[model samples]
Target: MHLLPSNLIIFPNWLQPEELLYLDLERVIKTIATHPDSNKIILFIDTTSIYEEDADLVVSSVLMNLLLLEDLDVTEEYEISLLGNADRIEWESIVSCIHARIILENENQELLTSFLVKNIPSYKVEDLSNIPLGQLVFNLSKKLFLEERWKEAITQYQKLLEMQSGDADIYWNLSHCYRHLNLLDEYFNTLQQGIKLYPTHERLHFSLIIDFRQNGRIQEAILSADHAAKCFPDDYTFQLLKYLTVPSIYDSQAEISFYRQRYTQGLQNLIQRTSLKTTEEQNSALAGIGRLTNFFLSYQAQNDIDLQRQYGNLVHEIMAVNYPQWCVPLSMSKLQPNNKIRIGYVSHYLHSYSGTLWLTGWLRHSNHESFQIYCYYTGNEPDPITKQFQEYSDAFHHIPDNLPAACEQIIVDKLHILVFPEIGMNPQTMQMAGLRLAPVQCVAWGHPVTTGLPTIDYFLSSELMEPKNAQEHYSEKLIRLPNIGVSYPKPYIPPVIKTRSDFQLPDDAVIYLCCQAPFKYLPQYDFIFAEIAHCVPQAKFLFLRGTLLQPRLKGAFAAIGLNSEDYCVFLSIPERLDYLMINLLSDVYLDTFTWSGGNTTLEAIACNLPIVTCPGEFMRGRHSDSFLKMLGVTDTIAENEAEYIEIAVKLGLDLAWRSTIAERMSQNHDRLFDDKACVVGLEAFYKQVCSKH
Candidate 1:
């Protein structure tokens, strides 16, 4: 007889129904009842189980993993006797060490971790020698993974793999550790291994699709999504994921239109067909949906507030179905003058990413006495930026990846305002954004798009970025702050001096630096490159190397009768200093049309480069324009495409005008950085929101 585990028991070796299949849980319950204060287990087994497979099941220590599934309150321990033939197994091979636990949730995990350490007083974090190897290592590994201590967990999991080579979970979790460490190659490789080794592992396959989309390999992601949907016919997650797959960079405008149409049709079909019959099915489907985002939808340069609201409503409905209590709007308590209002911020990008560059300033410059700052960082990596977030906040929580556990943690905090730095960029953030965790829920401009979720009460934006009609762009009530909407800290310039030769730039050529990622370059703007290359013989557009979308740009150049090889320069820079060097050396900074630069523009301006921008209809396109307006440098701000090309050309051709613009940028750029007024406005906004609601 083999009990599979918690809640479910399986007797696999029932060769004769009358004997082996006659076992029931009544006798086991009776045994546990009698020894209520002690650990007790009862198993009905005999020599009728003669097969070697049956003996292996009874003998293996891994099967004992079930004891950890439930909350066992007993103070004493129990023993098991393995019945096996002498030739099949030796008596000494039995593992008779103390029983181990598997961590199910954060509370139980802490208890188990403390228990393990108490057992062997001197046991180190990595040491698993004193206890039974498999159970302790697995326990420690899960603990470390949940706590975002990935490297140590990787060590323990790798040890588990050496013992059980065929373990699918080990491969899945190792891949998870690699992902948290930002080891993309290892992450991809391990996912591939898991997919090939255990083709039926649903999470491994879907996770690969997400990885592909994240790394800008959208085509591969689409293929993997299609394959995974076919493989798991019953699971609606894969089916929904197929529709959620949006490309970061489009080869053409028509390609964008095609995908937009496909997504709408696919989403409609998904809505019509999705009818989850059981609680498990509904939970799984919603979890998968929660991990998806409409981040790429904003890049299309169209108004999607209605579409977003529709999708948001669907997500809200699903969330309400899965978590009724969490979806309900929380009641607020009016704060006393002496008491600091508890404010919480949640995001995965509180680490060394573009998100921290803009948002951390708000944290750094906030009035700590009047308002308490609590950060729920969903990301795994611990960087210098993350350390700063911890230092600046009142309570910094490195939240686990599990949605319910993380949500419960935030609920327990009893925050006055729960803020998501951005909603659409991260899946878990999106999941939380759809729920009313606090009395006042607000989303900032980290991703710079409105979350259509009804749960969000406010959208924080910049006065300079949003147009007069920008109120119509969001589902939430818009709250615009002064001067670029961010208390942006000035970027530190490395003191190293370098010549143009260090980067292999042509001495005679006029370098136009387009520092935005390849996705930011719309297909219609490809003609701008060919036009500039045709006009100025010495024009060379500089871009960072190692992206798949570069070839599409090259092809666009080729179609317009220009060999991008001669006119474009793609160089691999070593570090941020080198990127800043490119900004310093470039003749003109060319901002993308529809999706204008944010952090890159700020960095380039800080380096004293003249930014030429043509703001689009949406706020996303006006970031650089806002920065320029804030700096009192308006000469390079173009009103149209012709003006954009003309301004860019003049900046490239006229050295004196370029220098004049650079000098003006250098003089007035101080006003744009570390603006305490922006923080003051934000704090006031928070106070106003609290009082009104």
Candidate 2:
């Protein structure tokens, strides 16, 4: 059998089918028995797609077969070219077939050296700088990104950008690198440039909206969303982005007015646009009109259950149009007894934040034998509590921030049950929760409201936390657990204590601690604070400072005829101990109206502080009341706003009554802390729900 002796011979899968046919080869051999008269052999291997299993196997097999060609000339110059990423490949197998591993991507010899040491181990990689400029720079930049060398990646990508400015992916990635390096200006510039180059690019445009929102540039974010919608008028995702951009409520009073104005106008504009002749325009307008955040926030202010359900249906319809392709159901046979039921938990707060405090107990006591826990985290960074959550889970995935990627990963996991600790808090997670990625999906009361998503099967609530007909409040089946559906861990009191003097509080003054975030303080609730302050002459209302500045807070207080000087806004104390100490320093803990505190209330209880709470119609407004009830301290549980003010005044001024309440709290506080029984109820609930599904 005669074989061709070609100097530029490419592998079977490397070249195109046309190129293969043009070669007109007889029988392709892995190795050539080199003639004594053979000249220099330049072997080029296209390992670009070697990350694929088949390609890796083929390349490995071909290289191994080179040893079979014993008569092949060894003296002639043999050059090997590696086309793509070699860091992940088993380079030793291929390296043995060639003299040196030639990296066709990067010019940085040090990068090649480090990669060789870490990946191939003890083998050296040569940076072949003579390769094509665009391919070399693109690979080098990508390699830098994979290695998490952010600054280097930015430089390399920027260099590549000059050569191929039209590449949207490059711009997207380079902007990400700039973000990781905390170069906000560069990040903005890169996205702007990318959008200018590729105006219709959804990914880059979507990123601009996300970047602006994450950085607290709400107006810019809304504008970016508007730009995206205008650029891609028929794109459902951009339309969704526009709808999500301006939240009805905001963290600060300045933003509250700004957002309310924006959303109110935005909604009205959308409604007017809904009358447009184009069905596409009408659909977008209708979806915006029925957006969950705006509707839910509006219902919260007015307690309109009908409006809530109406908006929920609207959102469901919009989601069906936006994400029409539902995930295929997992096989029942996959749920084998010995295999253990795969229960996945998705949350952006798997870290040390107050949101994850109650969840830690369930994770800590998870039955590893009966259930396998998978945690998909979306928070910015993991903390000590995050480590604990990871320790208890069978698998811990730091979910990528991208919506589609996160949702795709959850779908690919084939979870028997997927739970979102809170869906409405994070827009990215909210987007994922709209997809049917599991056999069963549930949302806990971390957000303390219904998700309004059709994909969500259950609202995992606590029996103690909800009203008699709580099912009517939720779109999903309300699965009420025996207690507040989590076992609370005992609050950690750091040994170092803070005093009133440390916070510059007067010893004789009655301190009323309303420690809820600013947004939780509805303008309607400002009257209660003012009334309490007026009733107790020496009262000082201490609130945890949110994104709102003193001026905004002062304006809120001034609206109700209260002097700003009568209250103190405490900046967030990074030390948990300091926070607990501050709670201890207060005479009365006044829970916020409508959206009451959960972890904050528990912390006050643990510190034996008297909390005055006026329960509202919804479960969100009743958490503090529930905890107070659990502890058997209903003296501070008010029936109305007047009673709420009266209780707060009594606690603030009447030292004897306040002391008695504090004593009762001291005795009963243990009842609410670390109830492991709640964990058992939760596990049973999970089992029941999974079994039913």
Candidate 3:
């Protein structure tokens, strides 16, 4: 076999059929024997030959042989080159192969570190005018991206886009390159162009939604998601996108319920379709189901355990199983004998939100001597809560940049137990958890669902949050905490109730209040409330206004006939603690379905305000149910629209019963306000995880 010169061995335009086959076979065997470093081997198949059946086979054979040589060490000095007639080959097949090879070769050190560095800069746009050369550029660019040479990757993607103008995939790749480079404007513009060009392309629209979200264009993201859902009602991605987008505009509970219903429908449809399909179709359906199942489990959302177990079994049957990725980085058995158990809590919600507010009590009281608390703060905002968390933890690391790297570093530090306080809600936090940052990873109460990712080991739950029978819905093992719920103290002082007269309301009216975010109020909720108002003619609905009372949001509410004084009252309170004052003025608290209240509900209960809650079908929707149960206020739990209205009316009419409940609730506030209990439970959970590790 004659070795071709590295520079002159460009793709040939034409060759005899037998000659090409022979050359391909020779290259395959040589590649096998030499095990040429991926960096040194530049296989250039003339996509022109890809259309010919035998030539296509030859090219595929060459690729297979090269892939087989992956684990073998071949001579590093000589490079392997394959020249194909691009005009004869099937362009799509050739492009797909090129993409696969680029991804695969990225794992080869010699190729990733040296060959990419050496050849990427040398290959210029002008040099790739020919079709085969252009394909080569695309492959190299993909390799650059895989290697994290983002700047060079952008340049390469740009060159390809310029050459293959209006190519949706190329444009999509360019958008990704721009995104990876943090060029937000260009990333979104490029994706929008791609969406315009390929309106039916679900992936492009999905990318647009994600980009819009990452760029902080929440409204645009929702709009894009809505458009996507309308366009592809049956597409799983569209359903997921709709589910994800709702939290930005509506209440978290409502968003969770809506998505969970969609997910269930999607999953059931997938399973039914799989049963009726051919083998190939079944395989595809299984893969789709796997993705959905994983998604549900990844975020600790409501899932069907039997469905997930079936999906997991199918996945295992189809794809070869390997040890979980987290186990690859560290020797778990070796680290068990260590004296100090390093416990790491991974969260993006360590700021002044519900997650931080709820978990801070626990973090503050974690046992520092037995369990070393490592706070991995993944959020961008470093609020007062984050500062408090840092001060409380034994070690605190802020990971606002390079999340995967930070996670990997944490894993390297050999933390015994890693806890994810929130997942699926925050991208960076999920990404970090996906990297497997600890030996024993547990998902706690950041969001009210399971993290479907395989990296997470346990779902930290109470009997109320996840019943043992429902364990199958989650991907992780159920690690139950003691008691009905996790508790947090009211750290800030409750603001004194301001008179309705002070806030410009009628002095004699019975106030019905909803302190939850306005976005959580669905159209159905508006109808329910309207019905409630029709029943209780004396009651004036009051809403605690903050960001939700923005002009546009208020206008939206007004359109639903909830305008100021007519059906609603928006009280703009400057401080969050003032919410207590607002609650005190109201005769009753109306909790929204789908998205129930968290901190606000707790505060309302603490203020002895009767909270009327409608429990939805999913875990997120049932939060208020659990809270009410824990507070021994099951009478406040409404099962449906009719029941909710009935409960409100009953509470409004029976002032004596309301007074008795209020007095009891004010006395029972101590049970829910046990800051000490939260601290103890959290410390125990941490200790247990460390001991197991």
Whose lDDT is greatest here? 1
lDDT of 1 by residue, 387-474 (tens): 9899989999997577787788889989989888778877788887878799999888888877889999998889999999998999
Model 1: lDDT equals: 0.74
lDDT, candidate 3, at 117: 24
lDDT, candidate 2, equals: 0.66
By lDDT, the better pick of 1 and 2 is 1
The digit string of per-residue lDDT tens for model 2 on 249-332 reads 354446556655555555445434433345675465444433324423542343434543544454555445555565344443
- lDDT (10s digit) by residue, model 3, range 412-458: 66777777776655545654555445667777765666555666678
| 10 residues in a row with least lDDT, candidate 1 | 3-12
- Pairs in steric clash, model 1: none
Rank ordering of all candidates by lDDT, starting from the highest = 1, 2, 3
Better of 1 and 3 by TM-score: 1
